[model samples]
Target: MSRFAGRFSGRRAVITGGASGLGKAVAARMVAEGGQVVLWDLDQALLDKAVEEVGALRGVALDVSDPVQVAAAAATAQAALGGVDILVASAGITGATVPVTEFPLDNWKRVIDINLNGVFYCCRELAPLMLAGGYGRIVNVASVAGKEGNPNASAYSASKAGVIGFTKSLGKELAGTGVMVNALTPAAFETPIFLQMPQSQIDYMKSKIPMGRFGQVEENAAMICFMASEECSFTTAATFDTSGGRTTF
Candidate 1:
């Protein structure tokens, strides 16, 4: 699939968290398919390395949770890239694993700020660019945990749940505006985000997947590409599952 060409030819994309993990995988796929991608992440060094690795991919150090930063980045990105046609809201973090009753307030807020709020900030700022362009594709990377809440992962679960809701609402609002908004709910994939979780928690998550293993980054990226492509017409305010048989709906 990496050898395939021009799936996203002549398109421009803004991908949050594209420095690594699932986000990087998607960026690679898009660029390989002939799309121009501008990646936004918090780590400048990693973003630089990723851009070099992906070849022709642009990098920006952005904190998506900040609306001011998001707006500024959007303006700069639009100016440089001409305009954004697709947005992959993949920047997120999984806070510490703990029971809701024991969850620290700060951790909960942090998770929400990044995972849920970040998605909102990106869409709120960038969707207008797409809307004005008269075309757009938004694929918000949510989680299966949002559907079937993971025990002891209250903050992560809640943030993702909020994303699902936000995607639906936003999708509807943009239904007739030549833009489609959707969410991808993937079950535990072997991404760097795993480093933030306990091994015990990881094992428990694996146990819930009928596939009996973590998902592959490529698999999720494939779905995202389809969702971000013109072939994804007529699907908005919907949740596409990439959960390895964990979610049939």
Candidate 2:
């Protein structure tokens, strides 16, 4: 596992939502390969636990949905980490599963604010630092539901779709720069985020994946690590699919 020790040596990374799920997996992978990682999450206890387990990782707790907080945290990260070489915008939420017409207005806004706007806020604040450093990798965690809309999860789907679009636009804007922006579209995964979804919705998602199983966090971390590595130079403004054949398009 430490075979790729030099792959991320001397690199500093920021992983939002790094306290758990796919984000935690990616953070662990980065650290295992010799990178310095700073985890950002809204849960103080989880952040503390992740830092304890990851060892040497710096954890910052803040709501990514707040632009002001994100900006301030990014500044602190620059000072603490010296400069950010990689950013994995992994923070998100799965709002209520009710139909669009019945979807509570508050729920819709909450999902959009966290899932979509939070990503924008992170990129908005951190991209400049990357631009100054002249070397950066940005991987945005989107979902298969974003491409193939899932019934009863309109807000989650829409927010992720916006993430994909935003990645494409930002990738192009930073084309000639050292920054590479891309998104990962994963199929259903058995993460705690499922707690937010209805049972029927979860079963429906599982049935759609041709593999007949949900994705593993490690599987996603592998793909993410590659995308965030120096080896991923030629690709940008694109979406990487980890959907187990659910999205061949």
Candidate 3:
């Protein structure tokens, strides 16, 4: 048997931003471990492709920032998969890199809406389902920027920091219950999202990491899988750093 045998068999997982990057990686791993996954993302074509590639999976088009859509999506997923056993709130965006003074309020709000409010929406909608089931695992995708603010990415940094705080608070609220909530603070990873960033901004991020390289999606996915499993029973309301030594703290 695999070392992770029975880790997630018969479990149902819902991953936001599951069409690509770290979210997709986690979904693939969960299914490999015998779990069913419901992937929600804004990109319908990509989501459909992911669903086709990963057996025992379903895909839904969703904008995480939209409460109405998220609620509807959650209801559909719960109906199809028999409720969520794990939730990975990974939908986010790295907003434009501009000095705080130059950053447009609209851009900042957009970033916060998707990264911070999006997480809240998912948790708010899904937590009740998990609570009813009497078991759940929640892993919110945060960033090293959340812990240590980056120079040119104020909105992204602040939003992710909010995610960390929110996860901690929720974890505490669910204490003594079977549900567990946690956040992962990852350093730069070679994901498609990086392509959206300017090369100079990317270089600045790379220079800060002591590892001299970007993190792998597989590594982040592995960490997430562990956090979502029954094996992660003890830890909750905590931050797990996968920063490749970028964060000495």
Question: How many residue pairs clash in model 3?
Answer: 0
- The local distance difference test score of each candidate is 0.93, 0.92, 0.93
lDDT of 2 by residue, 1-249 (tens): 766776899999999999999888888889999899999999989999998888646899999999999999999899999999999999999999888889999989999999999999999999998899898999999999899899889999999999999999999999989899999999988788998878999999999999999999889999999999999999999999999889967
Give the worst 10-residue stretch by lDDT in candidate 2.
Answer: 50-59
> What is the per-residue lDDT of model 1 for residues 130-160, given as tens digits with 9 covering 90 to 100?
9999999999999999998999999999999
lDDT of 1: 0.93
Model 1: worst 10 consecutive residues (lDDT sum): 1-10
Candidate 3 lDDT: 0.93
After superposition, which runs of candidate 3 have C-alpha atoms over 4 Å from their true positions?
Answer: 1-5
Index of the highest-TM-score prediction = 2
lDDT of 3 by residue, 20-57 (tens): 99999888888888899999999999999988887546
TM values, all candidates: 0.98, 0.98, 0.98
User: What is candidate 2's TM-score against the reference?
Assistant: 0.98
What lDDT does model 2 reach? 0.92
Q: Which wins on TM-score, candidate 1 or candidate 2?
A: 2
On the 0 to 100 scale, the lDDT of residue 245 in model 2 is 88
